[model samples]
Target: MDRPRRCVLLKFGELALKGRNRPRFVNALERNLRRMTADLGPIEVRHRGGVFIVSGDMPQEELAERCLGLPGVSVVQPALRCERDATAAADAAVELLRELPGHTFAVRATRRDKRFALRSIELARLLGDAVRVRLGLDVDLSNPDLELFVEVDHKELLVSVERLRGAGGLPVGTSGRALVLLSGGLDSPVAAYRMMKRGLRCDFVHFSGRPFTSPESIYKAYALVGRLDRFQGDSRLYVVTFGPAQRRLATAGAGRLQVLSQRRLMVRVAAALGERLDAGALVTGDSLGQVASQTLPNLAVVEEAAQLPLLRPLIDRDKSEIVDAARALGTYDISILPDEDCCQLFTSKPASTRGHPDDLRRIERTADIEELVEQLAESAELFHPTLEERAMVSAATPASRGPSLG
Candidate 1:
């Protein structure tokens, strides 16, 4: 008997419904999968109808877990490649079941190749009887303690007992590129993840209260970006120190409109950076009425300052939903770390919820908004969080420079 080889069975969700554009989406997903797992070792991806079979040097379970984070993938099954016969599949199933603890089990077989002698039900029944007779396990169809899967393809048969859920959406870069206004907060990182799920290849921009404040928030933002980079590799974070700019806003007698004015400037600076990076729009974590600065009126006032379109993925979502997503995305811990965010500096105790466009424009004039935007853009520091060497391009002052990852 030949030894069973481990492999991953990958399936996509929405990409399958793409009709004429399905191949393009699948190709994009393939490229993304390879890039995401390049560190693991070389891998081969073979497309068979709707599912893809990936074989590589890395452990199958580890490879499946890594592929789960990739967008466009719906399900990942780590299985053993066996001979294309019922006896081989039942043998593989018994081998897999021995490692998994379950008294009751169900065999679910899918026969994609008609050339197979037995039907799908026949294969399932054979495996189900084998597990029942040989392993002393009962069969439960509705709610089983374990679900053993046997997939029959043209060339081979795969048997497994576990199915991992993937990050279901279109492939990253399929929906074009956008820049996320990533803050050291709960909402923005979640917002960036949401956009990435929608296939937007997103880079991040973080505004830090440097010079007037400590580098704690910059470190937090750096950590946050590093966490998010796992979903979409080669993540870039541009940090702009805005303490001086905020001080100017405060001295301009903006009063209750201080936070609103600061937010507008941040958007302007982000838009400036976005232009150079060719980002079509800017993404934010604004949940409607979540804070005074996020009120509808204030949000509109801030949106006017952005040269590119502003996308708020969490606008309609409540705080709880955003928090839950943050926890799941693995950024909640980093975001909750104490740090003085740039917008929090020079902010009034009670910010205006209904900030008028004219008043913000007037404040912009007093602060020389365009010139300030230009300066902030020029001083932006670029960091690639995924790279362990702490590779960065420093265009800002020494104080604005990020701390060593070590």
Candidate 2:
């Protein structure tokens, strides 16, 4: 006889707290799940009460595994559906326990179908007796080696032995959007991930020093976004040519102020693009005092150029903490690859602490900030990696040995 097909059950965490906007967030989560799992095969996704049930030809375990990365999902269980009868529910619980390896077990059962004669406690006791008689396993409610979970809803009872933890947060796109200034470095990608965890769907804006510098940064940004795509589905990358703008800033001969001027221009350009994309904010990976351009007064001076909120997710984190998070997110290896960042080009001595707004104004006199931002926006190259491109990136070699620009 063929084994009964199983389905994965998903429960929402913070998303459940939403009052009137609950359906919107739930719909967003459903869309993301469908898009991420479309390649697995044909699947059926249904939401009942507060739980989502996914039934399809795809292996239930694999589906549960894939759902671990989805935000708004709190728990995943591979459950077998059975008729909502005490005997059938107990039999299904025994079948699940037979496959699981454990001598000490506990049955946590919930009876939602009021029409069923057995109460919650009665159903748990019945299931426990069945396990004890059929399999001879001792019950330890406090600390069990394995736990069999049963949920009786409407006309069916769902039974499972294993429950997996999910990535818990508000669904992406439930919050407003942001434009992330993604550099080919460890911090920016981590910043992007943090913002996504907060429910902000992010589009990337990368400034590369092509022609004047290697094309390594562009490829690195692509690889970085590819990893992030797993979380937010698809991402759009705006690559702006920054070499000409760097030269313009250097022409001012403001010495240490060149870095500050360059940052101001970058933020200005990012804000402009952010408005174009209708992003509510701009994100960066700036950590306090990590670099010469990130000083308190320097950050203040640079932020004056933008009209929108500049969100620095890593502002308070130390480099070590940021690196640890990067490694965990699987972007550390790619970010550590050799690449010439535009910010590192053409500058030797940068301001150690801060630069005065008076000195900045003096330097601003030499270059047309408006023209530079407009030029960057005009020459920007937009990249939206196809699903195939993302898959290729996932299977390809590490970025260090990966393909380079011709």
Best by TM-score: 1
Best by lDDT: 1
Local distance difference test scores for all models: 0.85, 0.83
Query: Residue 401 CA error for candidate 1 (Å)?
Result: 11
Model 2 earns a TM-score of: 0.91
Can you write out model 2's per-residue Cα lDDT over 268-352, one digit (the tens) per residue?
8999888899999999999999988888988999888877899998999999999999997878987887878788666757464
Q: Judge candidate 2 at residue 182 and give its lDDT.
A: 90
RMSD list, candidates in order: 3.6, 2.8
Model 2, stretches more than 4 Å misplaced?
A: 1-4, 391-406
Give the alpha carbon lDDT tens digit for every residue of 100-184 in model 1: 7778999888888887999999889999999899899999999999999988888889998888898998999889899999888
Q: How many backbone clashes does candidate 2 have?
A: 0
In candidate 1, stretches whose alpha carbon ends up further than 4 angstroms from where it belongs are 387-406
Which residue pairs in candidate 2 collide?
Answer: none
